[model samples]
Target: MKFTVSAAYYLLALLVCGVQADKEPLKDQSRLINLQSSRHHDVRLHCAHYPDWRIADEGDVLHFHSPHYPRLYPHSSRCGWQFKGKNEGIYFTINCQVFEMEAASGGKCKDYLSIKDESQQSQMFCGSQSPSLTVGNKVTMKFQSSYRKQAIGFTCTATAYLS
Candidate 1:
């Protein structure tokens, strides 16, 4: 098959990045997908609704942060997001760039972010520490704040891939 220069470049880039495409669609998005890191562009997220879901494509870099980032988040606020591969068999990973919330007290966090997957793995995060974690193609993130104290929320990016 004759390939154009751009086509060849695109394919080569995919290979170098370790992303692939197959004829079969992903049966279970939660278990069949794997995540790798890549940066293409930035997409800022607006947590206007209680829960929202977004589709991620290969090379997509989506950003999510608290309302009025770089400032104190509102008390008693809640937000959530769910990300899935736009195309079949695609995967993604999240890297937290900024994380600052009310620190945990007595092993409990008044304000925190929770990450969960279909595999039943759930993790809560708070304070200034940022976490980079791997999740299935389908994952959910929820941020909650109490009426005690507030701090600068979090900024995270989700990069999509395929394998």
Candidate 2:
């Protein structure tokens, strides 16, 4: 009878310790998942700063414009979009649908749409004109406004294709 009681006590202790050992790894895994989820949220918040910015991949067509385009854009604001090709030899072509900004002071535009290519050269445009440009693999479009008078901003579309 004494041996039976001692055996029952030993079995009960082993069961409790086994359950605890299983729970520890599960707790660590839950904490790791929570940490990864928070990091992903932070990355999304960082991208939110460019409200009007867009990304275009190869064989995709994307339209971008200043904030509140067609109506006057806000003063002292900057916005842009980036286009990337899917393949190394792919390129992008862009067309302006409606382009209007504050006129240039001298030869340089005050409020302007700037197109930059992979070569790092930039072409600036202003006023009510439509322009077309082709760039290699990657292109970035930036629009800037001063603190003074504003104008209806630009509307443009970009298409990517293999070279």
For residue 17, give model 1's deviation from the true position in Å: 24
Candidate 2 local Cα displacement, residue 104, angstroms: 0.8
Best prediction by TM-score: 1
* Candidate 2 weakest lDDT stretch, 10 residues: 38-47
lDDT of 1 by residue, 8-111 (tens): 65676578665654434446767555645654545777775566778787888888898778888998998888878776677778888788888899999889
| lDDT at position 69, candidate 1 | 89
Deviation (Å) of 19 in candidate 1: 25
* Residue clash pairs of candidate 2: none
Error of 1 at 36 (Å): 22
Could you give me the TM-score of model 1 versus the true structure?
A: 0.71
Question: What's the TM-score of each model vs. the native?
Answer: 0.71, 0.64
Q: What does each candidate score in C-alpha RMSD?
A: 10.6, 14.7
